[model samples]
Target chain A: MATTRKSARTTPAAERPHPDATRRSQRSRQAIYAAALALVGEVGYPKTTIEGIAARAGVGKQTIYRWWSSKAEVLLEAFLDLGEQAVHAQGQEAPYAIPDTGDIAADLKAVLRATVDQLYDPRFEAPSRALAAEGLVNEQLGREFVAKLLEPSLQLHVDRLRAAQAAGQVRPEIDPRIALELFVSPLAQRWLQHTAPVSYAYTDTLVDYALHGLAPR
Target chain B: MATTRKSARTTPAAERPHPDATRRSQRSRQAIYAAALALVGEVGYPKTTIEGIAARAGVGKQTIYRWWSSKAEVLLEAFLDLGEQAVHAQGQEAPYAIPDTGDIAADLKAVLRATVDQLYDPRFEAPSRALAAEGLVNEQLGREFVAKLLEPSLQLHVDRLRAAQAAGQVRPEIDPRIALELFVSPLAQRWLQHTAPVSYAYTDTLVDYALHGLAPR
Candidate 1:
């Protein structure tokens, strides 16, 4: 449901004749997204309501209800927007996907290093953690977050790994879904659980250890 | 700090003369732990007060303060106690450590399989998930959880991997700490995030992938 939402506005939308009204609508949507993220981060999921988001965004309650059915939908779209903004801020093009550079190790390491930076970005950290914490207990919201947000990014890794397999980089027998977790989950656990520090060198080592067995080659 | 507190009392404490008083104290403590776990599981971390736990446990508020400093401390000890109970319920002896069966793959797989069982156990699942969710947002609580509960278990994996390294089963330069995550964190992420289903077969595959390179040998 969230995937189909056009989170990023294009020049074509701005190119519409009633430019003032379009700009006003865009401003209201951005304010609502920011307010939703901030409120969720501050008070957490259970306490955050559409009324709170509307008040925080300086819009009427009807404005939020007009756009989203629930606080979960609002937060989901807010997160998706945050991700796209983070990507654009990094000077990457819209619709970020894992690079398939032919050298699987180099490709994975580069993407993970980019991920390390994204994880550290203050804009992305607090609100994302807030939603994730809520998702741990709330089954419906958790599944929605996974389907709309996480699974899409993970599927990019699957695609990259499949490309690697075709190129004889990865073993054909490997399941890319499970295989991607070797490097991804460790960084995730560290970030989510505060288990350890993450760094470029650390992620680099993960790629190496994963591509080459821990057991002596 | 939490590690030093002996969670499981042995016969020596039970063997002391004043056996009726000792039995009563033990029963009260068990009731308190049960109350803490249940309350956290139901209401979540922020709202679970010591007074509330006492009310649920049918003990005075003073009884709780007499033993622990804060709700975090109580929950920590409660989790530690829960872990010990799970181990005992598995019919394993006290000081539950991973078995070092000389075969590194087999040893790791066995431990992970046991972990799969533990994750599925209803007694462990709800409270543990609740606490983990709290840890994601609560920095101090999260760090304490890592230092006391998580790191000790991870250290056991490190010890076993170091043994493997010594035996030339793992490469000499391999950092046992990071290597363990290639398998461990995946299971943890799946459980914590509900990112996917976890099963013995899934974990068994993780072990096989980690031990053998995803790349062609």
Candidate 2:
């Protein structure tokens, strides 16, 4: 989400500008992220501690403390990094923004299809679910993660919808914030609650139904 | 919810055939439900135990096991009872079906407004969040609760959509299951994730948007 926070925490020691130090620091950070995700996924958010994460990552506890304030921060950054990795793996660049392909429907459908794949990705599923589960009851963490992680992504939708409105695709009077929910929240609930199965077809239908209305066109 | 399971578990011993036994049994059952809800709310799902609920309710462990198979079943029944009680408090009868006033939008809005109130209700909020949180990490429990506690309520929406379709209020080709999510899921995700604040106005907007579509009509 916030590039500044990630960069500030993840960057190598400013005093040690050596290339080898930077490489080692990058390896350690990646290890920390991996350990944090795996620990949270296996033991859940409540039981996962910084000590456990450091132990699992083969890093000193001081090293983890030096970079991040809490396990929550670590997990949050890990998830953000995981998202970036997923996008890069799909051959997209970092800070991936929604495509403005001049066709709102096609662009929205493409993003949602990608999201469906991400939701099903084994790498993303367990840790995400664990964190989400904790967020439900842990109100402070819930609000923090929503503000930092989820809201930034949701804002992208608002931006796209506003663009659509300017282009005469979406109604000018519609609230982009609420309009995005019509398509996004259903898939989220399905994934979070295991309420139903999700797929390209399901998300495509959501896009069409959102654009065309459930009532007569 | 499944009425048969509730009735079978909640009923007094069939062999007793005495009014006193039935009254005592009903009192014990209510006490157990209240205890289960309070305990789960206080300590969350993982830490809550049958012995703990039994002690809190001042009932024997055998009484709990005799009636229900596990804590999940107990909590599910308690929530079902809580919903029934909420409806009753609203001066509505049990088995509270969605109203079909022939104006599909109005009917959906009315139910959603009631749901917003229910979500805000203190009695339902904490325990419900705790159960939902646990359900996220625990697959079998999640599936079981969704099937028993959630799907039945969702089915009400499906049924209402089907009626609207029959009456030509909704398009014939719309899948009631998917169509219902347009309005239902957004509210659900908001409540579940603390993604945003929910209110009657927000839900009313959802109903309007889902019915009318986001594009220019």
Candidate 3:
């Protein structure tokens, strides 16, 4: 159910009527994000609530209500914020677009190795899995997550592959979108299904195999 | 949470005392399988219960208790039965072995196409997704399903790739186990995550990309 219960405000916070960057508001926003993420990780998506987040964040319920539209929206933005923090921790800029070193194989392999690390990172693992598990059954949320969170990252690979195609490192005929899945999906399945362990070595091999045909040249 | 409450009647049901092939027993078995699949598909894995399946199947709880120890076990067997039925309907032998058409690409492509069909099959899709989603968050059950259900199917791919290697169609150095994922996991991610549509063409493209590699030869 969409949480439209909040009485129509004189102004919706989504319009960002005021500059939202004040130190106090920033602290509260960070706390809310942390609270929402930790709650979802611990209790899962369905059990988590705005009350829980507000209490955990040491903020009033109205504060959260004023900032976000719904719990799902809160979590989605929280994950986005978390991803940004991770990229920052890596000393990278926002978006953390996949590298295009012009050595296509090395660039792809490097990014995938980083992905292996991210997939195993404890801070993100439980909540990401929880979100993913929910997404499997919840089609609308699944598609939203894919569109907002996943597809953007996937598109970076598409851009890298298109450059590779132009450089003649990749076949012009190959579809970059589908080609990226060759490596990405293997790591994803292994992580998602507990089918196997993921590692730099495994991802390195995937890049190798994806670029070089499995058959003897 | 393993169920060990059922008193062993000095004969484990796995060692069926009766042939269990009699028309009446077969009918009851089919009904039980149907009930288990239907219940889990509707209510999901955690909420599905032995009592529910038995009641729905028109069998006593003791009848179910006699056969399987837990709802998980019952659902597992029902899926296995369903898979077997699918194979039988294909006019194939018990294992639903991938074709060894002497052309590795054609054989792998053919198998993947069948897999795409199976992924889209309404009978398998919802229940499998439910079990799989649960498996993501439930480590023990996830590992159990992978070991028992998933690994066996993957081993078949390993076998096919091995034969292709023996014929020099695949590189001997290639590990068939990881090699198979190059095609299989893409289809799986698309189906599981709702990231994209599953079709014979998509699967066919996966097979081609996997075998030929994305790089120019």
Predicted model with the maximum TM-score: 2
Q: Which tens-of-lDDT digit does each residue in A76-195 have in candidate 2? A: 999989989887888876466899999999999999999889888888899999999999999999999999989999999999999999999999999999999999999999999899
DockQ of each: 0.84, 0.84, 0.76
Better of 1 and 2 by DockQ: 1
TM-scores of the models, in the order given:
0.92, 0.93, 0.90
Query: Where does model 2 exceed 4 Å of error?
Result: A1-15, B1-15
In candidate 1, stretches whose alpha carbon ends up further than 4 angstroms from where it belongs are A1-17, B1-17
For model 3, name the residue pairs that clash. none
Output the TM-score of candidate 3. Answer: 0.90
lDDT of 2 by residue, B20-95 (tens): 8768989999999999999898899999999999999999999999889999989999999999998888887647
The candidate that wins on lDDT is 2
Model 1 in CAPRI terms: which quality?
Answer: high
* CA RMSD per model (angstroms): 4.4, 3.9, 5.4
Tens digits of lDDT, candidate 3, B26-112: 788899999888877788888888899889999899988877798888888898899898888888975758889889999998888
Backbone-clash count (model 2): 0
lDDT of 3 at B191: 92
lDDT, model 2: 0.92
| Residue A172 C-alpha lDDT in model 3 | 99
